[model samples]
Target chain A: MRSWWRVLGVVLGVSVLFVGAWAEKLVVIGPWSGAEADPFVAVLDAFKAKTGIDYEYRTMRAEDLSKVLPAQFGAGMAPGDVIFMWGWWIAKFADHMADLSDVIADVPFAYVSPLVVDGRTVGVPYVVFVKPGFWYRKSFFAEHGLKPPTSWPDFISLLKRIKAIPGIEDAAASGDGVGWPLSDTTEHFILAYGGVNTFLGLIDGTIKWESPEVRAVFENYLIPYLDYASEPIEWTSALDLWWEGKYGIYFMGNWITGMVDDPSDLGVFALPGAKAVTGGPDIFFVPKYSKNLEAAKKLAAFLMSKEGQELRAAGGGKLVVRADVSPTAYPPAERALMKALEGFTLVSDMDDTIGGEWQAAFWDQLKLLWVKPGALDDVLRVLDEKFPKG
Target chain B: MRSSPRAEPRGKGEGKSRRGLPLLFWRSSRRREEWVAALGFLAIGLVLIGFFVIWPSIRTLWFSLFDAEGFAGVRNFARLFGDREIVDLVRFLRREPPWGALLHNLVWIVIHLPFTVGLGLILAVVFSKIRSWWVGIARGAIYLGIVTPLIVGGVIIRFLFDKHAGMAPQILGALGAPVPWSAGWTAYPETALLALVIGSIWLWTGFSMVLHSAGLSTIDRELYEAAQIDGASELAQFRYITLPLLRPVTLVVAAMTFLWELKIFDIVYVATMGGPGGASNVLALEMYFSAFRELDPYRASAIATLITLFSLPVGYWFARRRLRR
Candidate 1:
């Protein structure tokens, strides 16, 4: 009886040791809610099937992710082995992320080139969208004798011509009364003329805000639009303006193409400027305290897989990250975006929702300044103070 | 056995022998128990106070003193003071057209408070007069609004008020009125306020009504009968007796509503994000932008501290009054 008891105890101990040693669960954090969950869920399933490692997924808003991550890293709770984030957020969370330089050798050229943070690869690109392109009603544009303008001066001339039309209102300039489209258009124009590097330099105070080039872009491009937008913009009433064929031009993202899903009323075209190409990159990162690094790497690899790249195209978007995928992975609008990408500089947009020093200084303060009329000099001074010389 | 006569002397002798020590220990033990009870209560209270009130207050106070980097000192507060909008808001008062969103908050409170309280009171009165089953159903229906998540409510409200194809414009358009009710700031502030108020009232009126209904149940029906017999009209009876009787409840509800209105955020964020050029930016939203959204935690804390300071005195005074009564 004593020998039997000893054997039982030994067996129990061995089982316990085995269980403790081989406990594997991957913790993943990403924006995978509702419709966004499909691609991630499929990829996670594929990973599980391949590696036999189960994952715990936590979906959070991109904004909340930024706020929570700092504390999560600070408190050693960042159990995120893999993370899906917006393009601009990667820069803010660069310190806490692991180097992906080895991993990037396998990614596409487009993703590889732009997301190089401080000579270290911080994140990998997965999904890409551009916000400042001109999306116009094709039927209306055709009727009103409008074509996609390929230069800053031509774009203004087109706008002037459209505004001169007897009863047409300029595409919904409400922006919650901030009247923001003017600046967004102006920034793109500046980028087209001077390139992305020059534009970023201006924002960071390396290039002077008072320079003639910057002044010319604003005075020539932005002021005219603002003058046109002097009338009260009724956003709620302007909903059908795009669909009703009442408005000829709308400055927005290609994602607005979904609005034309009714088939008969859909038309989208790229904005043309001196720098005829414009778009922003999407970046994904791995959080510092991820419990399952290998599983995360596998998932990241899968996201950049051929099948995953096809999902991006299926969602009516672009996938420039996977080396296996062709440029044909982009839809019509995205194809134009791809074509335009060669000439115009890629805007180094940051997700302001991510908490950063640059966020408080440039994004939020600029938003407030854009809304209310305040001292431009003071605003510039504050921006310079925040981003001074380095 | 000489027991009866000598027993008294024996008892007396024992009492005399044990007098000082027994009395001293008995009194001391009771005192010690009382002290323990007092200390135990104090410890529990202290823990509650520390967790809920003291710690957050200290953290906020500490945060306000520093800049966004949260070093040690009054730089953030100094910067807030130095901000042009804040300066102009204080110096020029109403002379300034836009008052750094401070005026917007005041306007929100002024516009929404009366409507919320009045509607709540009416709902309470109606609910009280109804049968219990009807009251339950009505209560449930009202609570549905409250139970709906703020984001859901905000989203629905946004859609309901969408400009061209939204329910309002569609209804109006169907009625052959070409008016644009949900368009720009010039036309939409009133509509926006209405939407916000409608949502807030839907979620919160039930709470106030329930409080009022509870208050109503405690009222003496005999007093109402006497008033009615005395030829007092319903309005007069309500004004004179019910209003005075319900004042305590009114005070509680008003303060609660005020605080809730002061901290109004999620609905606005979900709806318009205080857009159309700061049309709906209440102080709470402004503070949030200052802190988390903008990463200006210092200014955010300062604004929160000011709100806390403003609320504390009133809260304490009311609490003390209620306790005394």
Candidate 2:
């Protein structure tokens, strides 16, 4: 009777130990929500099936992350073991993220360099998207005898011709308001016309925002159709306008192709300029306070692997950043984005380079400048107030 | 038994007879129990108020004095007023982003607040005379807009006035107005806040009506009857008796409505996003943007503190009136 009681105790303790070891969780957070989050969730599901690691993904938009992450971090709550974030958010969260250079050593320098802060790679690039991608209806371009423009002047001429096309009410479509839609267009234009140094200089404080070159880019490339273009609506509705065949060309990210009704009917290109392409990659990193750092690192390493990249592409129709990984498995639009990323001086989007408070100001103040063009100096002055000149 | 009787210092009759002073501050058995009972009743409520309200307000005020880097000073507040864009607003220059946004919020208060209260009062007055279940149903129907999520409602409003695919332009065309409905009211800065105001009115008038309904229930019917018997007109009865009696409720509701207007965030956020170039921004939404999007907690806290200070007078007035009651 005494030996039987001892055996029962041993069994109970073993079972508890097994459960404790296997049931530990790894949490992940990202900025994709609603339908955009659906495919990514599936990819995580695939990851769990392949490896016995258990992780939960929480969806947060950019604005929500700005508030929630700080609050969570301050309270010593681990918001995520692994955080899926846009590359631009690296600066804002660098202090809280784990240095991942050695973890992602197999990833190429080009993909890893953009996310470096204070000489440390803070995140691993997992996905990529090209910006200022000019999307037009394939048949619409054919019907109007318009070929993709290779020069800035040609692009403007094409826009004018599109306006002249009878029954085509909107010659070009740009989403309304003070955010990525407008700012991206301005950023790429500055990159394309003003060159890469002029673009980078905006972030480094060497280039004046009110310079003649910057003014010329807006005056020649943007302001001509400012009043003529559609009123500022959100991207979804603007994409809807393109889908309905009302707009000739849409200046947006390649992701717009995913939102369209017929992906096959669209053609895309980086806006014609001085050979500088504005784009960035989506990345993930382990936060400093993660309880399961080992598991998080394991998941990130797998994510940067070729098979994992393929699984993600299959899952989210995402553009992969790894040059080692082929784009053949991705959707035609994503494949096109991959092809476009080659042989170009890749510059991060306008919002990414000058992140934090200035980005918000740029977004809000751009609209004011849009309505009152004479207030450009005032807008510049407002930005200077936040980021003073050395 | 003899020893116990000798040990008794005061007789029961003596204890009850006369107190040298009021026992309020004295730690007598009965007074101590009363104190405990009062504290016991207040314990949970006090804790919740302290944790959720008073504590956060104090923390936010403290946060206002420092920048993101832990630089302790009033520079955030100074920079706030000194901000080129905000200074533009202070001067009412109207040519820039912050200027127009701040002015638009003022316009919202001028237009949305009065109309919401007026429409609510009108609905209450008209419905107050009815003697049917349908009146309650009607009030609920008007309030349906309020219950609809702001994001969903904003989307619907955007579609409603859409210049191209929306019905507004078609209806206008039918009326021979020939207006540009395809571009949407949200498309233009001049019309964006106006569109938001109309949406706010639709959303909030029912809230006012309900508040007015509650006030109407408290007014004595006999006062109105006496006024009518004294040859008062319907308008005269409302003006002299009903209006005077409903003043307390009116003050509370109007103050609340004003607060709502000042802090207008979701509707504009989901609808206009403070655009056609920052034309629809208000103090509250700007505060949120400053805190989260800007990551400048000092400025955000400053804005928050300012908003809280503005709410204090109205809050105090309401509290005083309720206490008087």
Measured by DockQ, the strongest candidate is 2
TM-score of each model, paired residue for residue: 0.76, 0.86
| Clash pairs (backbone) in predicted model 2 | A176-A232, A176-A233, B163-B181, B163-B182, B163-B183, B164-B182
lDDT of each: 0.61, 0.72
Task: Looking at model 2 chain A, report the run of 10 residues with the lowest lDDT sum.
Answer: A106-115
Model 1 Cα lDDT, one tens digit per residue, B114-163: 77677777787777667776778888887677678888877766666665
Q: How close is chain A of candidate 1 to the true chain A, as a TM-score?
A: 0.71
DockQ of each: 0.15, 0.46
Q: Please, what are the lDDT tens digits per residue for candidate 1 over residues A55-130?
A: 7778876656656766677786674777766555577667777776776566555533545678877787776556
Q: What is the lDDT of residue B49 in candidate 2?
A: 99
